[model samples]
Target chain A: DAGITQSPRYKITETGRQVTLMCHQTWSHSYMFWYRQDLGHGLRLIYYSAAADITDKGEVPDGYVVSRSKTENFPLTLESATRSQTSVYFCASFNRESYNSPLHFGNGTRLTVT
Target chain B: QKEVEQDPGPLSVPEGAIVSLNCTYSNSAFQYFMWYRQYSRKGPELLMYTYSSGNKEDGRFTAQVDKSSKYISLFIRDSQPSDSATYLCAMRDSFANAGGTSYGKLTFGQGTILTVHP
Candidate 1:
């Protein structure tokens, strides 16, 4: 019951439309991360939050926005979706202070922009 | 060059054979190396981790890291059909996310697909 969950396990949006993917965790982990997985690019970090109300951009943050108003939720928004934005998005959480803490991930939300 | 690189192989092997997956990185600052196994359409799950340059064994999985050469490897003994998946190599500077100068970010490889056939 204490696990990460991503909503809309799959999504489809038209280009120029706004889409928001939801991520929630019952574990109350301090660090939350959002990453997009592409065909040839593996997983690239889009954004991460250290705690409530604290968020930072990741390796490829363009066109994406995230906010952590509460420790349980970290949502990623695409201001304007594009065809290139079609990919699987994963949400992960961890207690980073502990070096051995492995990131716990959600099932993921697959988004496709046409 | 990418911080981490891995051979994206659909490496086919007979069941019970030993399977080796590897990754190379250019960053000498990476102090923690991890291997993740991801089944198709599933998010990667951490398989094993090594804090320093050494080997750690867990059941059928073994992880080895060599800091001097910036190479890391994961070996699966007695590979099985259930072991088939994309193995991703991830590294992090454990100190980055602390209050000091790092952010504890993770750099992951492209992933290698492995299949154990009967």
Candidate 2:
């Protein structure tokens, strides 16, 4: 209850269907991020939010959308899922005030697109 | 070349053996370095952190960063079976815009999987 949590630990969706991965943190960190992890690629950032209503793209933002309406929640969405998008998604957060603070991550949502 | 490179190793060793893990980066702008340990089906948690260059040790874990070579390393002494997990290296640039929004954004290397057999 005091840490980050992700819903739908595993998911399977058809190509072209929209799917949303949810992330919620109880720490109220100012910075939140979404990353996709795949074999050989490690983890690639999809999007990040500095604060509520402020979001920006990261290394791999194509085809994925993110929004942070509140400081405690950041959700990632695939407008139209593609087979290539099948990967484990992770959400992370950190207190921006502390430059050296490492990110605290959620358990992650495993999304499989077929 | 990718900004960060790490071997996705399934490195296996017997318990009590010293373990070495490393990562190299191509970005000269990166100033902060970190190592994370991830257990099966769990999110990664910070294991070691170093800023810029030099070495820092905590418990049986030591972190080394060489800015000149753009390399970083994590070493574990007298490893235990519980140390078996994936290790990820991450870095972030020092440059932040006037808004100070991108300072926390990190670039990660492919994780190295290590198993310490008991």
Instruction: Give the candidate number with the greatest lDDT.
Output: 2
lDDT at residue B8 of model 1 (Cα atoms): 92
Error of 1 at B52 (Å): 1.1
| Cα lDDT tens digits for candidate 1, B35-92 | 9989887888999989979999999999999999999999999999999999999998
Interface RMSD of each: 1.7, 1.2
How does model 1 score by TM-score?
0.96
Q: Roughly what TM-score does model 2 have, to 2 decimal places?
A: 0.96
Candidate 2 backbone collisions, by pair: none
Off by over 4 Å in 2: B95-99
Q: Over 4 Å off in model 1, which ranges? A: B96-102
**Model 2, span B55-94: residue lDDT tens:** 9999999999999999999999999999999999999887
Give residue B81's error in model 2 in angstroms. 0.9
Quote the positional error of residue B102 for candidate 1 in Å. Answer: 4.5
